[model samples]
Target: MRPNKRDELVSKALNVFYRSGFHATGMDTLVKETGISKTSIYKHFRTKDDLIIAVLRLRDENFRSWLFSRMAALSDAPAGQLLAMFTALGEWFGKPEFAGCMFIKASAEFQNRAHPVYQQSTEHKQMLLEHFTGLAKAAGASDPAGLARQLLTLKEGAIVLAAMSVTPDPAGDARYTARMLLQPYLAGG
Candidate 1:
């Protein structure tokens, strides 16, 4: 089924926000980029923040779906799937449109913890943590929570570095570090 106007607007706005950032992309910019009139956008969203929240939700769904599916496709075992996440990141970083994590950008622009946009950003990361924790448990890590947190740190750090161009291949660097971290849990490290 084709997406409705609201969904279409949100989808277009997501690309705009991803490229230009939350604060940097104004309503006018959104209108121009998304090709959705201000009146129509307001019909679906009460405010810019509301539209931002919707866009973040769409981003979270798309990102997690892509990352998880890529991981699964790369490996059959739970532990291998965990490692394959870095491989997926490598591919994403290579994309011409790559612009780092949108959640990170949103939280940075909306710094107040109580802000809805910030909370939404936090929720996205928490959901990711939950997924990592589940994978760690399934992989039989003695301390699943600990492993998950470490992996999340590595993942976030890799994203930052990749976005900054601080290193030629942060994903490869992350995968190397992840191997060391997961060595104990792997069949033979």
Candidate 2:
């Protein structure tokens, strides 16, 4: 089925944003990439920032769905799922088009805390941290919040390292570290 103009614009905008970033990708470029007229684009989104926010929202939904589904497929145990999350990251890193975290990039570019893009990016990251915190709690961590923070650090660090290099498997390293940190929380430890 053919996508509506709005969906098509958002889909194309996401690709362009992923490749050229929100700040760098111009409206003219979006017009060319999406093959949508400026008037039409403006009709759907009042401004480029609005379109960027839409793109970020799309990314947040898609990324979370992928990660959660991937983690679910790996294991049922909370501790196992926490450790296995890196396996999902590894799969993402292995993708040829991997270009680091979009939310991270957005937050970096949209520095103002009150900015919508920045807020969306912050929310995306916060969601990930909370998700990890939930897993830590379910896994019976002695200090669930601390473990969540530690695990989130490992996860984000791995993302940065993986994005920087094409060789070394940062996800594998993160998984190992997560396992070590989660040891006490696991049933046998």
Candidate 3:
């Protein structure tokens, strides 16, 4: 089914924001790329910030759904699913359209934590941490919170290094680290 005008605008704006940047992609660019007039854009989104929030919401929903579903499909064991998260990320990084993470990009552009965009990024990360924590607990980790923190670090680093390097395999490296860190929990240690 075809998306409504607002949804279509948000989708196009997300791609533009991902390719250029939240701050770099101007209203005029969105108008031109979406083939919708500035008036129409304002009708849907009162301001550019509103549009960005919409784009981020769309990205968050789509990304989480994809990542979690992929992780579930990859492994039946809780611990295996934990490690498979990095595998999923590796495949994502390998995609032709791969750019760094959208939340990371948003954080970089919107440094002020008080800002709505940065807060949205933080919320996205917290959700990831919660997911990791749940997996760690289910896998019988002694310290689920700590394990989640360590894994999140590995994931974030992999994302950054993969985006920065010319021929990156940061995901593989991160998964190896994650495997090592998750070892004790798997062994009932």
Error of 1 at 167 (Å): 0.4
Candidate 2: which stretches are off by over 4 Å?
187-189
10 residues in a row with least lDDT, candidate 1: 180-189
Per-residue lDDT of candidate 3, residues 1-189 (tens digit): 656888888898899999999888888888888898999899998889998999999999999889989999998778888899999998999898888999999989999989999999999999989998998999899899999999999999999998888546898999999989988765542
| Candidate 1 runs further than 4 Å off | 1-3
The Cα error of candidate 2 at residue 82, in Å, is 0.6
Error of 2 at 143 (Å): 1.1
Tens digits of per-residue lDDT for model 1, 1-189 = 756999999999999989988888899989988888999999999999899899999999999999999999998777788889999999999999999999898999999999989999989999999998998999999999999999999999999999999999999999999998888777655
lDDT of each: 0.92, 0.90, 0.90
Clashes of each: 0, 0, 0
Candidate 1: pairs in clash: none
